[model samples]
Every structure is written in C-alpha cells, then in structure tokens.
Target: MKRAAKYIIGVMSGTSLDGIDIAYVKFNQTAANDFQILNAITIPYGKEWKSALKEGFHLSGEKLVKLDADYGIYLGKTILKFIKENNIEKVDLIASHGHTIFHNPTENYTFQIGNGPQITAITNIKTICNFRVQDVALGGQGAPLVPVGDELLFSEYDYCLNLGGFSNISFKENNQRIAFDICPVNIVLNHYVAALNLEYDNKGAMASEGNIEINLLNKLNSLSFYDEAKPKSLGYEFVSETIFPIIDKFNLSINDILRTFVEHIALQISKKIESNSEKTMLVTGGGAFNTFLMERLQSHTKTPLIIPDENIINFKEALVFALLGFLKDEGKINCLKSVTGASKDHSSGVVYEVESSKFPFSR
Candidate 1:
C-alpha cells in the first residue's frame, strides 16, 4: 500500500548557480495539493564548486559526464548535511532538479547534471530527478515545469511569477495551464555585478543608482525572444551567445548596463502580468528581493503584486519541486502538454528507490 501523506526533500540548483536549495516539505493529501514547508535552506556554493559548475557546461562530453557524476555526489553530500543539521530523518522521497547544463529544445535535447542514482545511493532516500528530459523527448521545451504546482497549489492567484535566474510566469488560460520564460534576471545581473566582486546588487541598489542607457534598453526590449509565442524558455547558452555580445558592444559603464538591463527585465515582465486587468501576481525568487526592480515593475502596471514571506520568495521553487515529486509518485500528470507543448501530458521524472525500502513515516 502507498501512503498519501509524504515527507519529501526537494533539492534544486538553478541556472544562476547561486547555491543548492533544499526543502523538507510535508505534503498532505487532505484534499489534494495541501502541503507545508517544514524546513528549507540554501547552501551557497563554495568557490571551487561555483567555478566548476560555471565551466562545466563548456566541457567536452567525456568531461561533462564525469562532472555530472561528481556534481551528483556533491549534491548528495549536501543533502545529507541538510538532513543531519535539521534533524530530518523521516523522508519518503528526494526530488533533485540537478543543475541545468544545456537546455535547447529546438535541437531536441536538454541535460541537467547530478546523477539520480548517485543521490539515492549516498542518501538512502528514493529520488526523482531529471524531470525535463522526458518532456523534451515529447517535442516540448522541457521547461517552466513549475506550472503544474502553480495550477494546483497556487490557483488562488491570477499569476504565479518566479524571478529566479530567468523570469517565468504561469497562469490558467481558457481552462488550460500556460507558462513560459519571460527574460533573464539574476543570470544577467549577476554576470555584470561579478566584475565589482559582489554576488548581487543589494536590493537592486546599484541598478537604482545608475542611469538607464536608453539605446541599450531599447535594443534589449526589442530582442526577438519577447515577440515569440508561449511554450518557450531561455538557457545559459542563449544568454552567453545572444545577451552578452550585444551588451559588450556598447562598452557602457557597468552601472549603466545594470540599470538598462533591469529596466528591460521590468518592461518584459510587465508585458505579461499587466495584460489581464486587476489580477494579483504572486512574485517569488531572488529577484523579488530587488527593491528597485520591484518598484519598477509596480510602476509599470496597476495589477497588485503579492510577495509572500522570505521563505516562499527564496525557496518556493524547491518547495514546488517537492510537489512535483509527489505528483510523480502518485503517477499523475505532473508535466502538462499545454504548458510545455509536449506531445501529451505525462508524469515526467526518473525515480530511483532503494530495495524494499521502509518508509519512515506511518500514515
């Protein structure tokens, strides 16, 4: 017999490479989609790990495979540490959104490192990971997977927008879920700010101080990605190839570049959330902490923005990934064809379970 209520650990390493987010979530099927975040923490990547991941994408296939396994062991060790430090022993599953290395759906391939077997072997917890590969296999973008959680867990709001490495929004459209990436956020901002030896612009202060380069902002806003239809996503490759070269050509001050790009991000996001009138947009992720960016976004639309507690703002993705795992465990449609343009709605994830595993919790 299977249990309805589960204690699961969700682990995520995003494109921003900020750190690994681990959330211990208790999902109760009181009626479906009811859950609580019991504990969550982000372990900032050390200098070595950060450097390795930053360069891992460019490695040869042979080297990339090795790096993938190594990263998996690293994630396993980190998850173990998180569980030990928090005294979390009872867990049904571990869902890891291993760091995304390459994501290009047009080529019909996407890869996220950190081996699932390595995680299960090291942590002794059943694991579900590599959630995107299946979606891509079905001729979809294999991204913006958070919408399934948004549809069930956060449907009260008109929009569920996450401003992480990239800005993505999910909402119900004509009784179907629709979601897609809007633009780059921390992925671009952090790249420029690294020149100043800062991890990020505190509350977008640096961007607030600088003047917007109108030319640059206009160019960025005019990028073809904004005009494309839904069921789309962005990756590090797009940024490194498309975004950086354009900005570098201008040779503007770092401050100006930051300010213009922030403006560009706000403009692009406003285009999506401000369309429907009087809607409540739930904003989360690192970008939500950027005061200047938030102010700019608010100014662009009359729609009210609802930002939850810091926990939700920071670790909501991890929490939602846990929900995705729960859906997969129940053999439900966790990845929507409508949201991802896949061939069909399907449960997307590879599960690894220990032999005759005893679930620590009793329902």
Candidate 2:
C-alpha cells in the first residue's frame, strides 16, 4: 500500500542561473501544508553548463533537441550527487521544474528541459515534471504556479511576493487567486553587475552609492508592458529585446543604471502594494537580500513586508514545486485559473517511472 506521508525531493532552476535549488521535503497527506523541510541546498552551475544553457536560445532545432536530452542526463546526475551528499535515502518521488529554455505563452508554447522519464530512469523513482506545458495548452500563462502553494501552504499572508530573476506577486482578490510578474529584478540587475565581474550587489550597496538617472528611470517606468493587465508573464527575450536596449541607449555608469532600475522596480512594485491598513507582504528569493531595493519598496506602501529566513528565501520555489508534485500525486488541482489564466483549474505535470530492472541510465 502507498504511504500517507511522503519523502520527496523537489528541484528548480530559475532564470538567474544562481543554481539548482534542491529541497528534501516531507508532506503529511492527511493535512495540507503540514510539511517539513528536512534539507535544502543550491548547486551552483559550472561555467560549461551555464554557457550551454545560456547560448541554447540560438541553437539550431537539431542541436536544441540534443541539448534537451543532454540537460536531462545532467540533471539526473546532479540529483544523484545531491542525494548522496545529503545522505537522503528514502525519497518517495522527485519533482523537477527543469530550467525553462523558452516561454511564450501568447503563442501557446513553453518548454523546460530535464526529461521526466530520464529523471526516473536514473534515480529509479517516480518523477513529475513539465508542469507548465499543460497549463499553456489550456490557454494560460503557465507561470506563477507557486500561488497554489501560497494559497494552501501559506494562507496567512495577505500577499506572497517572490523576487527572483523577475518579481512576481500572488494574492487573494475577491476570493480568487491573482498573480503576475511585476518587473525584471535580479535578471536585469545581475546582468549589469556581471560587467563589474561581480555575481551580485551584496545588500544593494553599489546601488545605494549611485544617483538615480531620472530620464532613464522615466523611460523604464514608461514601458508598455507595465500597463498590461494580469494573466501575463515575462521571459528572457523581453529583457534582451526591450529592457536592455532602453537601458543601453543611455550611456550611464553601471551603478547609475542599477540605481535607476532599482527605483523603477520599486515604483512599479509599490504601485501594486495598495496602502492597506492590515495587509502584509511575505518577500522571498534572492532579491530579498538586496537591502537598498527592500528599503525603496517599503517606502511606497503601508503594508508590512516580512522577510522570511534564508532557507525560505532561497528554496521556497523548490519547496512549492514539491507541494505541486504532492498534489499532483493525489490527483488534486495544482494549477490555478486566476493565477495562470488557464481555461480551468487542473492537475498539471507528466508523471514518469521506470522499473529498477529496466533502468537504462548508464553509470
């Protein structure tokens, strides 16, 4: 018989390329949100893998297919190493939100590498992945999926905002969950910081030193995407085709660019944080550590912004993907209509499993 509680490993790779976030979680089947995070870690990508994934967008169709298979194998080996290092022995399932290579929901196509079958074949465990495709097929943004976890696992918060590569917010409005990307965050900031040979703006110190360029700031704030209604999402293409070009036109110092962009981000996000009397915002992800950005964000709204612990800040998405897999395993809805603009609420993700004797993964 199947067990009520499950020990599962959830994996996620965000656009920031910060690394693969791995969370070993235990879910109590009898009660929702009754879960324990036994262990968590981020496996930084080597330059080789990073370059392969980054340059993959321009690859030929044949090469892209090969890269997909290769990435699946890479993910499997990495996960095996994580298991061995953590001394985790009893994983009931694996949920992998493979790195998104392409996402254009308007055209109804979104792809994430790391094959589910390959993951199961290597690990010899049941696996669930490709969580976004089904939602896109049903006419949805196929993003901000973590809101399902927010609704069930973190209902106490008035708003759940994640500041990853991009800033996205989720909250209950009229009893329906609504969420959308606010603006580009580290995806833009880190891009500029890399010019200085730095991984990030530690505590937003560099940005705090520069003066905001009003002209550039106004240009960023005037982007057409900001006025668009919800049920939308952003991709790396937006940054390349729209955001960077606008910023590059103004030949300003890197610090000035970061400073202006931070203001633009704060202003855009703050506009969404209605000056409520009792509501609070739970902020997480890498951007939460940027003190200067946080201060600017706090200046615009009366809502108390709560910064969670480092574990939650770094691994919350991985944790939520774990929750998504758990719900999918039980045949429950893991995608939301309001959040993803899907036709209807549905259980998303393809499940895979290979018998131990038939495992084809080579050692």
**Per-residue C-alpha lDDT of model 2 across residues 1-363, encoded as one tens digit per residue:** 555789989999998888899999999766677889999999988878888888877786889988888988888988888899988889989999999888899999999988787788888889999999999999999998999989988889999999999999999899998999989999899989988878789999999999899999999899999999998899988998899999999999998999999999999998987778598899999999999999998988888899988888999999999999988988999999999999999999999975656657777
Question: Can you tell me which runs of candidate 1 are displaced by over 4 Å?
Answer: 1-4, 275-277, 356-363
Q: Candidate 1's C-alpha lDDT?
A: 0.91
Cα lDDT computed for each candidate against the true fold: 0.91, 0.91
Cα RMSD (Å) per model? 3.8, 3.0
Over the stretch 232-251, how does candidate 1's per-residue lDDT look in tens digits?
A: 99999989999999999999
Error (Å) of candidate 2 at residue 348 is 0.4
Clashing pairs in 1: none
lDDT of 2: 0.91
